[model samples]
Target: MKYLVGVLLALIVFNASAQEEGGLKRPDIPGELMVDVGFNVWTSMPGGLERRTWSSKSIGIYYTKRKAFSSKLSFNYGIGLGLEKMSLGDSSTLASAVLDDNGTTSTDDDFVQSVLIVANPESFSKNKLATTYLDIPVEFRFHPLGTEDGEGLFIGAGGIVGLRLNAHTKWKYDNNGETVREKTSGKFNLNSFRYGYQIRAGFRGVHFFYKRYVSDVFKDPFPSGESPVMTTVGINVTGF
Candidate 1:
């Protein structure tokens, strides 16, 4: 992680130097920068004991450059940063224990002895819960248009990597007939990578897009033994 950060800083410095040496030059070509805002629908793949679904909003900013490397072929390159909110299902487990007879539930007569036992074991109290994430997406796009102004539609598919920025669990539980706020630190996967496919159609500087994830976001043991898929339908403010 440290090495990645160092490399990114070095690239930024190099770009700054290059820009300083050659002023700001706007290309005559057709391309654009985009700002995208959308919502996420998240669900578990294996369908846990309790099916869970949550909604989160995200915003992304990307810079795109489209140029033809050949007479019949052209490619689009883009780098973007996105912010998202994550959430989990709200549920809990309930249990019961027995009480001692000699101390609390004791009876003066020795003829009979009694004990307390548990009954309900599945129950949960609802509360506020959410997670935040930062994602980076780099993709190569293909368009049917040439060097002329934006006229037709385009399709894009790419790989996106993300990091968990912060997470917190909030809930209200009763203790001795009093409600108290409880918070637990959420440990989400620090890094996530997923591939997505997008279909977009639009004219100069505006496009509608529908995208879906093709890979699992969870890594390793997959603690929940399930896969989660995310899909979004949104718009892009760019000329592609």
Candidate 2:
């Protein structure tokens, strides 16, 4: 008898909660999850290096919610995680600054440098750096066709800020007669935080995204004429 009474009470409570949730008209609905795939690279460094692989890629996934301020204007905000793989032509590896503490004031105190990796090019076929980050994305969306019926074309512009999570380098090639691959991980004094402005345009569930980071990639005292900023162009897949 006691068990039967408990079951009845539980059913009553559950039914009431479900009715309140499904019967009410909600003003805001969740936007689709977003995925971005693209190519990435840095600018403002010294010459003689190049990117040779489409394998230098980037990817991100986000969960966002959209709230309407009007029939045509809405805002979306979300959190995401992303990875970037940047490949540099053989012979280059990041290095600490070469400092000369002479009394002469001509030497600039800023700017660490990248030194060459002396391995034979025949044996060293590839080298790339990879980094991961936790990202926060905010955008204001404008839909001219209105969202009353569902999704439509949207133009959004906003900012994305990232906090560094991990960084590493991978190398592959032949050493002797055997194929070999190596990985090394360290901070490399990389910047712990970064933020940039971005813009997107899409119809329904697909969008194109472009972003340029305003901060340096490294935390070192970099001298003038060096711009180690990162930039990417990609497509965002949403609605799933």
Candidate 3:
């Protein structure tokens, strides 16, 4: 969190200085490069699927093009890469149910289709799940003062869609005083696509953003109602 705050402050200061020096003139380029850093949380998480709030983080990088509808309103669209890490709490790890030769199962009793099993904390030093995605985002922005020079108060509402690129679980444990790090990669019944809504508001190039995904994180065997919904809130820094 401290690192995020420092970056926000630096971006704000740099943007303010640039505006002062350039005197409100719009940049030659109409596109902006944005970086997002945030904390991830799960809503309606199933029992035993607890997350370590501060350790679960998200990062995204995007290049967006803006089209002005008016001095105070504009449309923007972008493509980006997003990375997320979810560190489980209470020394828990994600596990997938085994399917028989017929690829069918009769195990719907679990609260979460993707099961989370608790292990002794002292037995493991690290445990986490990570995912990567290719993302596209669209937004309609309202800049109260004007869109030129990217100054003053601006508010935007947008939707984002992401295609899963990779997902995996990692663990580190001690084996007779020898540390062993293991990583397992699999589909894990995770959804191939995810969609979410976001709202952003701020001054100049630094903004606060809140995003929530309404779709379930898993598919098929994983019950939709029992799947986790992801939420992120954080700082966005934009540069031209």
Candidate 4:
């Protein structure tokens, strides 16, 4: 994660330096620096798994090149880094479930082959799963009445493809009158790739966006149509 952040910072610095050196013309080829803050809601979650809406959130940072087709239309594409956290509720946590030798479900075995949401053995003040992704976003945008220095009323439709970078669970609790924090990192059967549709509209530097992923959050061992689907609705801040 640190490496990825460092790389992104380097790219930003390089871009700024190039602009300062007059290597790029801002008005001729516009770009956007955007930040997304959103709430995550899951649909079709398996029984026993629930998420807290307020605590489940996502943040993203992106830089995109805007290629204008005309005064009122453009195509944009970018790369971004996303941080997502899901806070599980109902005193529940995710665990690895096992299957028997015959490839049938069994709770008593030691083979960790699938994911299961189970009650935590002890109460936790914080219990959450977090993931990181490298994302590619592409969109078509329309600016009505035209844009003035990248600020105006506009609407866009886009799609994003994300490649999973990491996944883990974290817990914070009190044990023996002392605070205890535990973190475990694993694949956890999470989908390695996800694609989604995005719709955004707003004026000036603030925008509203809604995103929904058609793919499942988990892979095999989870039956078709039984896994969680992710959706996000939130605000976007752009142009610095």
- Per TM-score, the best of the predicted structures is 4
Compared with the true structure, what per-residue lDDT tens digits does model 3 show for residues 1-240? 333356458656756665745375434565777888898887765545667778899988777887888889888799877788888764567665544468565376543245445464455667788888888988889998786755679999999999999888888887777888878886666888999999999974899999899887777433334667888889988774
1-240, model 4: which lDDT tens digit per residue?
454478569757866765746376443335767778899888855656667789998888887777778778878789988788888864667755554568575755434657766565567789888999898988888998886455688899989999999889988877778888888887777889999999989964899989888888887545334677888889988765
Weakest 10 consecutive residues, lDDT, candidate 1?
A: 111-120
Task: List ranges where model 2 is wrong by over 4 Å.
Answer: 1-31, 46-48, 95-123, 221-225
Backbone clash total, candidate 4: 0
Ranking by lDDT: 4, 3, 2, 1
Question: How does each model score on lDDT?
Answer: 0.48, 0.70, 0.76, 0.78
Counting clashing residue pairs in each candidate, in order, gives 0, 3, 0, 0
Models 1 onward score TM values of 0.51, 0.73, 0.76, 0.80
Q: Better model by TM-score, 2 or 3?
A: 3
Residue 145 displacement in candidate 2 (angstroms): 1.9
